[model samples]
Target: MAGHATVPSSPEPSSLRALPPSAKLVVKTLEYEGRLTQAELVESTRLPDRTVRYALRELEDEDLVTSRISFADARQRVYSLTTAES
Candidate 1:
C-alpha cells in the first residue's frame, strides 16, 4: 500500500451514460414507448433491425433493460427499462 499511488475518487456518471449511442437511443425509445417488441423498436427508433438487436443485447447485458416473451406473439419479446434514472 505504501508504494501505491492514491487516486482521487470522482463522482461518475450513471451507468446509462457509459452506454453506446444506439443503446441510449433504445433506452429513450423504451422510456417513451414503454414495452415494445424488437420490430416495434426498429420502427420507432428508425434503426436497422440488426442495430436494434445489438442495442437490445447491450442494454440487457448492462441490466438496464429487460425482455420477456410477448403475449401477442410468443415468438417475439417485448423490451422495457428495468431501472429509472433520477
Candidate 2:
C-alpha cells in the first residue's frame, strides 16, 4: 500500500443503488448526451415516453438531474446530470 494510491469505496451513494434500472439508464444517457428533451431521451434510450418520464422524475427526486425550459422550444424541457457541471 506504500506505493499505491488510495481509492474511495464508491463514487455513488447507497441511495443510487436503490433506484430502478430505468433511472440509472437515464442518468448514463444524460452523462453522455449532455442535455436532452423528453422526446430525445426516448429516441436515445429506445424506451417509451412513460418510462422515460418516470425515470426523469426519479432522477429529479434524487437531485441527480436538473431541468430547464428549452430555448429552442419553450414548451419542452431539457435535462442534464448535475455532476456534469465543471
Candidate 3:
C-alpha cells in the first residue's frame, strides 16, 4: 500500500499587494515634495479634487500619509508621507 504525502498551503504575500497605481503615485509625490496642500496634490497629480481626497484618505488609513493645517493658510491642509514609510 502507498501513502499520500500531506502538502501545506502557502500563505499569501502581504507586501506584494500595496497601494494601487494612483495611490502609489500619490505616495511618491508626497515623499518627494515633502508637505503639500490639497491643491498642490491636485496640480502635481493632475487628478480631480475628489479623487485626490479619496486617495489621501486611503493613504492615511494605511499610515503611509499624514496631514496637518498649513501655517500659511489655516484653511488649507498639508499632506505628507509618514516617517516610518520609505
Candidate with top TM-score is: 2
RMSD of 2: 7.1
What is the clash tally of candidate 2? 0
The lDDT of model 1 is 0.80
Ranking by lDDT: 2, 1, 3
Model 1 regions lying over 4 Å from their true place: 1-13, 84-86
**Cα RMSD to the true fold for all candidates:** 13.0, 7.1, 14.7
Q: Write the per-residue lDDT of candidate 3 for residues 7-64, one digit (tens) a residue.
A: 2221122521575667777776775666789899999999988888888888788766
Tens digits of per-residue lDDT for model 2, 10-65: 21667679899888888777766678999999999999999999999988888788
Superior candidate under TM-score, 1 versus 2: 2
- Please report the candidate that would top lDDT against the real structure: 2
TM-score of 2: 0.82
Cα shift from native, residue 57, model 3 (Å): 0.2
Worst 10 residues of 1 by lDDT: 4-13
lDDT of each: 0.80, 0.81, 0.72
TM-score each candidate.
Answer: 0.79, 0.82, 0.74
For model 2, the local distance difference test gives 0.81
Candidate 1 C-alpha lDDT tens digits along 17-56: 8778998898878876677899999999999999999999
Candidate 2, pairs of clashing residues: none
